[model samples]
Target: MMRTLFDAELNKLNVDLTKMGHLVEVSIENMIDAFKHQDKTLAKEIMDNDRLINDMERAIESRSFNLILRQQPIASDLRNVTSALKIVTDLERIGDQAADIAEIILNFEGEHAYRTVEHIPTMAKKAKMMVHEAIDAFIKKDLSTAQMVIKMDDEIDSLFQEVKQEVTEILKENSERIDYCIDFLMIAKYLERVGDHAVNICEWLEFNQTGTMNDHRLI
Candidate 1:
């Protein structure tokens, strides 16, 4: 029956999307190390592996399109396909943000990290964990866990604000150190954005079940 075929295709899409999410999580992990050590080798590796994320995006996109076209899926099924497309966009953007951080890492000449870098690694780790949990929620279709990840984004944003406040003080005390401090701010911002993307993943996951929430507090 058509229903059986649709369900089979749907399961396969979850598998592919989960695989893509795992790669994005690892890329973010490597980026954290790349920033922490200011390792050009690690930074270069992040850049090199970006194409793999690109390829994964393409693969998931193809699968999503096939499902939509062949299944003529509507209601929750349509939402799933649409959600997969949105998830890919978020994942690709996460990859881009990670690469951008890596490019900045290369400029440090593998020097000691910028003054506020102690927090960047911590923030990256938190954001990466949120992404991991969000992906797990998607795989399990666990709305409660997805909601928890959404709540955690609040903490990540707060941490980002704390880092920014500290960096502002440093820049005021030593204006000459502004260049490196700006890099630190960017790392903080990217991790914050990563948290936001995780929220997006949660948002779409929920949309299929309870319909869309008008409030995007993650914004």
Candidate 2:
């Protein structure tokens, strides 16, 4: 029956999304490790692999649109597909932010440069955790998980501010390390943005489940 075929297509969508989420999760994790360790080789590898995330994004977008055309999903089904469309965009951006941070990590001359900038690793951890939890929420349809991810973003933002302050003070006291401090500041900003993208994905997840737009505060 047509209904059975449509159901199968929806399942396929889930499979593809799970694949995409896993790819992004690994990318963020590897990026953070590279940043913390100042591993240019690993950072370069993550940068090179960023294309995989982009390709998966396009593939999912195409499949989602084709399903919308062929199946004419209504109500909850329509919302589900729409949410997939939105979430993939956020997920893709998260991939980009991770790659960008990896590129910045390569600019550091040594591990000591990383040590000078306090709070960056903590920020990276919190942001990466948000992305991981948001994807898990998507896969499991766990509203509480999604809400928790949203709440977690505040922690990342707070850490970012602390990094900014610490870096500014370091730059003022140690003008010689200006360039390195600037790079760390950029990395912190990227992680903050990554956290925002995770929040966006969680919002879409909430919308997909409830058929109502959650306030940013709620999500």
Candidate 3:
């Protein structure tokens, strides 16, 4: 009976963490959409939505730690709940990074977008997909999927580098557009950090699964 009760609590913790991740994922998607369209209204909406993710993050942290203390979970069970705690922090940080990107969009105010950025949305889409896959992998206990998501980080990084190079070239060719170039580049940097956080959550999930932290999980 005690074991069953412990399992139920752990399951509830996992559910809450995943729900928190989904909310962060939504913020990421909308932030990117707002950036792409230069939509101040949507950007404002994304900034306002950060509170929901923050509240869920705190709740998960409290619950996970409470379970750790009350249950004194065994090795594997300890890993599971502890990982939820760590991953929620990463998720909340990701939400903050996404919000930062939204704020950059807010700065544009119809003046910074020189033409159109074709790569930002694509990079955001891939990064946001990675966040979704990482959360799903944790909830489903699918180590294979988590590994795949970690590997995809390189692609997002590549896109970030590409954006940086393209923006630099544009600024060099046209000194008048330097401000717009800088804004766009800053936005890409935030997106790159978002992808890195996604990778961090994947690593946390893998560590929880194997109770090991070697690079063997890197696909």
- Report the number of the highest-lDDT candidate: 2
Total clashing pairs for each candidate: 0, 0, 0
Q: Cα RMSD (Å) between model 2 and the true structure?
A: 2.3
TM-score of 3: 0.91
Q: How many backbone clashes does candidate 1 have?
A: 0
Task: Give the per-residue lDDT digits (tens) of candidate 3, residues 1-219.
Answer: 888998998889878887888888889889867876788899888888888889998898888878878876888887888778788888998899888888888888645363466677778888888888988887787888988988999999999988888887877788898778887888788878887888888888788978765566421
The sequence of per-residue lDDT tens digits that candidate 2 reaches over residues 171-195 is: 8898998777778888888989999
Cα-based TM-score, every candidate: 0.90, 0.95, 0.91
Superior by lDDT: candidate 1 or candidate 2: 2
Q: What Cα-based lDDT does every candidate model obtain?
A: 0.83, 0.86, 0.82
- Preferred candidate (lDDT higher): 1 or 3: 1
Candidate 3 segments whose C-alpha is farther than 4 A from its true place: 111-115, 216-219
Best by TM-score: 2
The per-residue C-alpha lDDT of model 3 at residue 112 equals 38
lDDT of 1: 0.83
Model 3, global lDDT: 0.82
